[model samples]
Target: MRSHGGRVRAIITGEAHIHADKVAAITGCLVPFPNYPAHIPMQRVDYICVVDEIGDPAKIATGAAKPTTDQRKLLMAEYCTQVVANTPYFKDGLSYQTGVGGLTKPMGNLF
Candidate 1:
């Protein structure tokens, strides 16, 4: 944009990901703010403010945002839970890892 005579006074954003830094390197300043703008802070593009909850939930994860739920999957989760329960690893204070996927969704509820 600078090459095209475009001016970037500030960048009003939430999290400062890699893209934000790239812009900051060329822009005037970087101003990181919360997801809600009416709360506080205004200026940007020169400095970077890494904060939390700066993204709009409605806009975040445009695709594959919603979780999956179905009777077949639930039944499968129930079966899997039972199998896990029968395993020796299902003891107290047991720790397990799971991915944010459809199959794991129902399993989480069971646990």
Candidate 2:
């Protein structure tokens, strides 16, 4: 079970649906607050990828690290291609670096 900003989540690895069942059972049993009803809204969530193995990260020695000549050339070529594709819009005087930043307020502060 997990909670994201007051909304609870329950994940099931196997076929056991025990806790959800309990939540369903207790939703209606409130002796003190009979007028105030309890509700448990369920939603199915899914993960896109399941990565099993990861290669060891390449370690860099103490220095100003730079990509190899071949790597730099390849990356530069890709960047140039993207820039060329966007050149038409740039010619119309559109600045590229607009609306590219982190959230103005952290998610926790929003609620």
Candidate 3:
């Protein structure tokens, strides 16, 4: 993990609310109280994608490392669609994060 100023770099792609405070507590850095309530339960996944097979041109333009695949894109779209449909909290004004995967790219279109 990289640290700069008051920020601590932990997870590469996912919800910061999931890891930020825990990271701060583990590293003994001062935890910044979030303006929002910590009601979202912490979930642990077996794995999280840190890089994709198809590199995002947008990230590449900015020198970020990652790539995405067509298959991944298709799967992401299907899964993300299901997630949006199944979850009720995905309404207007709700904050959410999508990973930088090819499948996740079309999430906006789903909405």
Candidate 4:
């Protein structure tokens, strides 16, 4: 978690053994947030899968723009939901690492 001024940012990352579509489906199943803007800090998730003879390696990467206070809540909800729904594959494959803010928070209030 990172904080800037009076706002706090948190990123939750995990993996799933399912396809990208399925992950997106799970995200839709979770919460509905508005479109992500282009200038926000990015949070990505990757899913890797392998099925016996049929190897289906897949990944799901999602990002949201710097959110408003309410939007931050939505993002947290979505992140938590995604992590819980795909617990079995959490520690496998690639790890999900997200950075908040612009590398490091600026010295003063950025309003």
Judging by lDDT against the true structure, name the best candidate: 1
Clashes of each: 9, 0, 8, 0
lDDT string, candidate 4, 1-111, tens digits: 234422322222222222233221112222234334412222333332333433222322123333234655555556664654477855544344444332111111220
List where candidate 1 sits over 4 angstroms from the true fold. 1-65
**TM-scores, each model vs. reference:** 0.43, 0.18, 0.34, 0.19
lDDT of 2 by residue, 1-111 (tens): 344422322334443344443322222223453333323233321212324434322433112332333555455545654665566554654333312112211111221
Reference-based lDDT, each prediction? 0.57, 0.35, 0.50, 0.35
Candidate 1 local lDDT, 4-87, one digit each (tens): 222322222422222443223222333454444322233434544555546675674344543456778779889998999899
Candidate 3, clashing residue pairs? 52-67, 53-67, 53-68, 54-67, 54-68, 55-67, 55-68, 73-103
In TM-score terms, candidate 1 sits at 0.43
Error of 4 at 45 (Å): 22
In candidate 3, position 88 carries an lDDT of 81
**Candidate 4 CA-lDDT value:** 0.35
Worst 10 residues of 4 by lDDT: 102-111
Q: Which pairs in model 4 have colliding backbones?
A: none
Superposition TM-score, candidate 2 onto the true structure: 0.18
Candidate achieving higher lDDT, 2 or 3: 3
